[model samples]
Target: MNDYSKAARAADRVRIVELDAEIQELQARIRLLQLERYPCQQRLDAHRYPVLALPNEIVGEIFVHFLPLYPDTPPLTGIYSPTTLTHICSQWREIALATPKLW
Candidate 1:
């Protein structure tokens, strides 16, 4: 190759090395960010259902309101039933069963 071509090839090799280093730095930064994100994401996931954080009394009251007005009663089984609430989760089942108004 001519001197000019040889010089250009050497420059290209240097640029390629610099680019590879930059890529590695970016990848390391991404890994660090992901590591930082994980626990915060776990915390966020813990609170994903905000309603679950409410006090049992408040949740029971909310369940009471969800039923038909006082004079009417929800069915024993099916989507609208309080039994369905018992099936949702242990905490909810305990709350639903304890709340006389639900039955």
Candidate 2:
């Protein structure tokens, strides 16, 4: 009975060591996969969308579409304002400032 109990404990310890080694291997594999995915994600982000790549003239036309029909004073605050559009990017800021129709 004593020998049987000792063997059972030894088997359990061996299994625990094997499981720990497998866990470490899986974690290393996950790190490698994440490193591989980083460049692909960066490349995808580098490819600009059609709207963002549009000429400033076209972007200015789109900005003009946001204006009120009766020529009310532009809103000083909020995301809907032309000022908010300028805050998006340097190019948009230049286009918004250049287009007098937006003012």
Candidate 3:
């Protein structure tokens, strides 16, 4: 009976070791998959934003709304100025420059 009990404990220890190795391997595979998915996740997240999906014409119209009232020249330095729109992103910069109304 003593020998049988000892054998059973040894088998349990071996199984524990095997399970630990499998757990480690599965964890490594999960990390690899997450790394591979990161860039795709970033692209999906970017597309999810409403403003980024707007057409250039609509974005141009939105820029037009940011302008100062007539006879009041938009400041070149402050956050409310057209120059700030140019600083937002490359697309905004191009749109702001092309819109003669803002200048």
| TM-score to native of every candidate shown | 0.56, 0.51, 0.54
lDDT of 2 by residue, 45-86 (tens): 557555567898999999988776654766757876788889
Q: Can you tell me which runs of candidate 1 are displaced by over 4 Å?
A: 1-42
The residue pairs that clash in candidate 2, if any, are none
Candidate achieving the largest lDDT: 1
Name the TM-score of candidate 2: 0.51
Q: Which one wins by TM-score: 2 or 3?
A: 3
Which parts of model 2 have CA positions greater than 4 angstroms off?
1-4, 48-73, 77-79, 82-103
Better of 1 and 2 by lDDT: 1
List the candidates ranked by TM-score, beginning with the highest. 1, 3, 2
The residue-by-residue lDDT of candidate 3 on 11-100, one tens digit each, is: 999999999999999999999999999999888867876676688788888888898888888888899888999998787898888888
Clashing pairs in 1: none
| Cα RMSD to the true fold for all candidates | 7.1, 6.4, 7.3
Model 3, CA-based lDDT: 0.87
Predicted candidate 1 versus true structure: per-residue lDDT over 28-99, tens digit per residue:
999999999999987896699677788999999988987878777799998988999999888899999999
TM-score top scorer: 1
Q: What is the lDDT of residue 92 in candidate 1?
A: 92
Residue 28 alpha-carbon offset, candidate 2, angstroms: 0.6
